[model samples]
Target: MSNPSIIFIPGSYVLLPVYQPLFDAVSEAGYEIKGIHPPTVGLSSRQGRESPAPSMYDDAAVIAQAAEKLADQGKDVILMGHSYAGIPMSQSTKGLGKEERRAQGKPGGIVQLAFISCLVPAIGSSAASLLGRFPNEKRPLVSIDEDGWMLMEDPEATARMICQELPPKEGEAIVTGFAKHSAQSFGNQLTHAGYKDIPVSYLLCEEDLAGPPDFQREMIAMIAEASGRKVDVTSIKAGHCPNLTAKDETIEWVLNVVRKAEESRPTV
Candidate 1:
């Protein structure tokens, strides 16, 4: 593989701009990388107020469309997701793997599915199910209004959880960055299990408060059990929002991933 496109799916309610440093750095290093927004995040589209909220699949469609577009152009892709985005990103890879597309005489396809302190949910489980129903002990809580969008009861506290390593004042500012995302995206059961067929990597945020290290390990174990192979793992001593809290390190780590990916074959 050579210079594969790197597409990153941001966590729920968080917009793509937060990953600007990562994108800029990767691009500067001579690889194409994108940070895309899922339709459910509302500074953009959450449908009309009267319209039903978007599901995880809607998010999945946005991701799939962006990735396969690169694939169609004969560009290999490295699909990575952060936090809640893992669900949609994984679901997005339905028939877009390099081997799968090549089998159909098509060029380009996803070669890597990388998770950055993300939720690796089970098939038939929604991000909400794994989070809402069986959430990690350290995870913070946010309410959902009748319109089905999330409400952050305390953005300050939420920020602290995600950016635990940062100073309280600096972390507090990032609270405004979180948007009102569709609650339905969390509730919807995933119809597709894309990770099972793809080569996978996990960037474990050891100090994560949103999804603790134990939770991260559990998610990694799920893939190993299903695929009978351990996911390639990398550790970063940061909290949930490593991209925000540990920007420089995250950028360096991602660049390394790009270099290795470019040198390797598109095999899982």
Candidate 2:
């Protein structure tokens, strides 16, 4: 459990840079942090093309490769997923944690999974399924083009929903950096449920308009029921983007979970 690598997966339409503060804080606290920018979120002109847009499975494959590399170096990992990125985060870490690798006489496997106001779906479930259940008016914040790519319809509305606590300029920066997300990923079912095997923590953003508190609780309950263990949950009074709105608190909560995971690790 010494110096585990902290890998972050950001939600749809945003890039890894948005979590720079959280990354910096974790780094300053003496932990390595890696951000996985999902290909599903077309962050570059190359990715924005109609032809070669990536899906959730593709995103998970990329993350899984990263985790494997870290595991090969004998470093345990903490995989954190934000928003829609949770799907790939959970799916990617499956059978790649220290315990799982060690069981196979290999090194490096994920030791913890952290969901930050992210979707927690079961095996065979898709993030879109959960999102689709929301009222029609509340859903469809993003418009999906004919090419099966998704984009924010109104940046102002998006900012108010997820970044309401941030300053106008900072919120605008997030909006400006918005990318086109692949619609295929939304409907892709997860092959594995990492939370069922790996230790998990859920950071519930109470003021999240995208993922309401009650819905988060329901997801947590679902996870607990499926896993046959209670999922550790920490609450923050912020919008969807807590890493931006409540940076310091988010860091503390993350570190707290890291410490708990370290303590619970089996001593060799």
Candidate 3:
């Protein structure tokens, strides 16, 4: 059997920094790892500012193209999504077949999905809905600037949104790199979640302020119920980005999921 390959998709308004620790850990565990940079990061407005161009649908299109390429390689592929990227990753694994489409066989092509402190919404929910509304009915995703950067409309507010249990370093990083998100991306609803039926797992960071451990649990329970399979829930005592605080455990959890998926693949 060939070595398994893992694709790491980072969350909203940032590059691969949030995933670096986890990816490094996974690489050390003897699996091939790749980072998928959806233009959603730099293609938007400054952090907590306005968006560049709007459209989560456009983001999904880009992600799906990348996913198809990875899926075509015929390696046991594991798609792991962090934060907002989960929405697109969910859309990427749709309509794949296993073993030439055996009679009523389980869907294949994508082996598994793991969401790291993300909002993996049900088929009909939008990102805006996930974040809820701000005062005066303003949407959080609409605060991008002209150059498509996202920042906290109010730095203090952004701080509060992500500051519950983060360390001083993480809070500083969030202030520096916090970019704006496209309202269109947040508003872009998924037509169907391709990863909905795939075996899935959720990693909850118990001390995370961005997504909060409590919220993470709720999202996991919802996705698990909707997918009609119990999610393999793993809890870590880190902030929103486990790759940073709990790198070793994050990598171990990812490897476990990939190994399980590879083992579950139908043998020829």
Candidate 4:
């Protein structure tokens, strides 16, 4: 069998660079790793001034395209989504699983999904709704720009909410890198629940203030109930950004998931 490839989808307002450490670690472990920087997060200056900003659907399409490219090369793909990215990650892998691709005469497709301190919404659920807001209301954590983009509100708020456990300087650096998020993404609903058919895992960040442990537990339970299957879960004592605050533990959990996926593959 070909070596598996892992594609990482970062959280809202965060670019691929934010996960460099985790990427390096994964690469060093002898697995191929790719990071998808969604255009919906407004990282590109070209999208900054565009009207009718991009949505989560656009983000999912980008992710799906990347996965398809790897899958075409006969690489078993594993998707790792962090924070708000869980939604897109799940959506992108829908109907693109190994089994589904094999039926379509393709070489490979997504084999597993890993959600790290992230939203695990049901089909047709929007991020804003999952975060405890009614339709057309402001999202819980961040402030919105006049042009329909979302901002981190402030560095202090980001520190308190997402990276409380990190060293002060490190947390500050993360905040400084925050970019505007497309407000439209929050209202876009997921069309498919990939976890229902895919092997799934969730890493609960116990010390996460932004995505509280209790809520993460609730999402896990909900997913299991909806999918009618168990979701492998592991807990780590870290802030929302476990890849940064608890790098070693996060990588260990990721590797464990990969090993399990490999074990489950059929022998020739």
RMSD of each: 2.7, 2.0, 3.9, 2.7
| Model 4 TM-score relative to the real fold | 0.92
lDDT of 2 by residue, 101-212 (tens): 8989998789888999999888888987888777768653667777778877767667877888987777866776777888889899988888888878999999999889
Q: How accurate is candidate 2 locally (lDDT)?
A: 0.83
Ranking by TM-score: 2, 4, 1, 3
lDDT to native, each model: 0.81, 0.83, 0.67, 0.83
Which 10-residue window of candidate 2 scores lowest in summed lDDT?
43-52
Counted clashes in each candidate structure? 0, 4, 32, 0
Comparing 2 with 3 on TM-score, the higher-scoring candidate is 2
Please give the range of 10 consecutive residues that has the lowest summed lDDT in model 3: 133-142
Count steric clashes of candidate 4.
0
lDDT of 4 by residue, 90-189 (tens): 8888778999989989888999999999998888898888876423232235666678887765565567668888777778777777777888888899
Tens-place lDDT per residue, model 3, 23-55, is 777777788888876756663334333335556
Model 1 RMSD in angstroms: 2.7
Candidate 3: deviation at residue 61, Å? 2.0
TM-score attained by model 3: 0.82
Q: Write the per-residue lDDT of candidate 1 for residues 1-268, one digit (tens) a residue.
A: 4578899888888867778888887888888888887778867322223455678888889899998899999988999889888899888889899889999999999988989999888888877777764544555567777778875656778887888777887776676666778888888887777778887888999998788899899989998787776688889899998888778888887877777777786356
TM-score of candidate 1 relative to the true fold:
0.92
